[model samples]
Target: MSLRDRLFGRERRSAQTARKRLQLVLIHDRAGLSPGTLDALKDDLVAAISRHVDIDASGVHVTLRSDRDKQRLVADIPLAPSRERRRELG
Candidate 1:
């Protein structure tokens, strides 16, 4: 790592991902949910949504957001472009 990377923490993407995962685990534990529960939920959501719409499953994100006194589940699902849209862009 260069001095700039060291100074700016630019090479910490994997560390950041790990930290986020740990935070999710802590949140899940506090919420009385098993660590695997969120993964299962994400899978279920992808399946249900895929039945009705084309989605980029790989890009789907399902996470729990915790604020001061509230916690909320957030899902960011990316939809695939329709054939017409793809053709237009092409």
Candidate 2:
């Protein structure tokens, strides 16, 4: 380790962990929901989406991220091809 790492190791403060933990707190506060609530909502969304569409559930990424002036619920869902697409190609 370098001089900086040695000096910081005395107290063992991890900047990355602190930043990520604070971010999680802020996201839940801004969204007015706990992390568990967010997880429940995500599950509901996945179920609803899967009922009518084909998607890669494991590839979904959901988070509460900040926008310009407000917090937003962001989701990245990977969808499989639909019948309409196959028809168009045929």
Candidate 3:
């Protein structure tokens, strides 16, 4: 860490992360969904998607986004490469 970083408490990255989490909480509250409900929704999404395709469940991200007057549910699901694709890449 540089002297400037230490003096400025450059740990702002962690603070930003916390702020994002707080924003998510607010969004969920506004949308009338609890955190547990969100988790259950994510699990259901994983199960439904996994039935048809391979996915990296651990890396899946499901969140709510507020845009103008709309609250949108966004899901970023990472797909695992198929065996043929893996072999080709390897």
Backbone N/Cα/C clashes per model: 0, 0, 0
**How well is each residue in 34-74 modelled by candidate 3, as lDDT tens digits?**
87898999999999999999999999998888998899989
- Residue 72 alpha-carbon offset, candidate 1, angstroms: 0.7
Judging by lDDT against the true structure, name the best candidate. 3
Q: Which pairs clash in the backbone of model 3? A: none
Per-prediction TM-score, please? Answer: 0.70, 0.67, 0.73
Runs in model 2 with CA error above 4 Å? 1-16, 81-90
Best by TM-score: 3
User: Can you rank all candidates by lDDT, best first?
Assistant: 3, 1, 2
By TM-score, is 1 or 2 better? 1
Task: Assess candidate 1 and give its TM-score to the true structure.
Answer: 0.70
For model 1, the superposed segments whose C-alpha errors exceed 4 Å read: 1-25
lDDT of 2: 0.84
Regions more than 4 Å wrong, model 3? 1-22
On residues 1-90, what C-alpha lDDT tens digit does candidate 2 reach at each position? Answer: 577778777544578679989987988897898878888988888899999989888888788887666898888999976789989999
